[model samples]
Target: MVLYGLKNCDTCRKALKLLPEAQFQDVRADGVPGDVLKSAYEVFGAQLLNTRSTTWRGLSDAERALDPLDLLAAHPTVMKRPLVDHDGQLYLGWNSDVQAALLG
Candidate 1:
């Protein structure tokens, strides 16, 4: 399992603690690969974008209007935390449902 998120993010840190075997990928430093982002977008659609994030708040209206892929490519932090790739399946966030699906 590979988890994609910012190393400093509390949520990511918690997720790492929960799943010690999961490999952590710092999206800020390594960036999300094109294929991974494409697949994530396909699976999650607009849910992939964290519109409530400070990064999203900082973006201009024009930037907000841009394509989701382009927005994500330019600002990885705008993504919701703890995107997990487990057994070729993509899961977003560490919510109860995700926990049940991944941990249970």
Candidate 2:
């Protein structure tokens, strides 16, 4: 499995602690693959974007008007933390429900 997130993000750190065996990919450094980003958008839709993030807040209205994929490609931190890909299934976020689904 692979976890896509910013290494410094607190939520990503917590998720990493839970899934030590999973490979960690820092989206800012490694960049999210186009295919994976496409798949994530398909599965999670707009939920895949973290609108509440400062990164999102900093985006100009013109940038916000861009397509979700374009926005993510331009600003990886705007993605919701801990997008887990396990056995080809995509899971977004790291809440109790996600923990139960992935860790249980």
| Per-candidate TM-score against the hidden true structure | 0.96, 0.97
Candidate 2, residues 1-104, lDDT tens digits: the string is 99999989999999999999999999999988999999999999999999999999999999999999999999999999989999999999998999999889
- List of clashing residue pairs for candidate 1: none
lDDT of 2: 0.94
Residues 1-104, model 1: lDDT tens digits:
99999999999999999999999999999989888898999999999999999999999999999999999999999998889999989999999999999888
* Residue 6 alpha-carbon offset, candidate 1, angstroms: 0.8
Predictions in order: lDDT:
0.93, 0.94
- Compared with the true structure, model 2 gives a TM-score of 0.97
Worst 10 residues of 1 by lDDT: 30-39
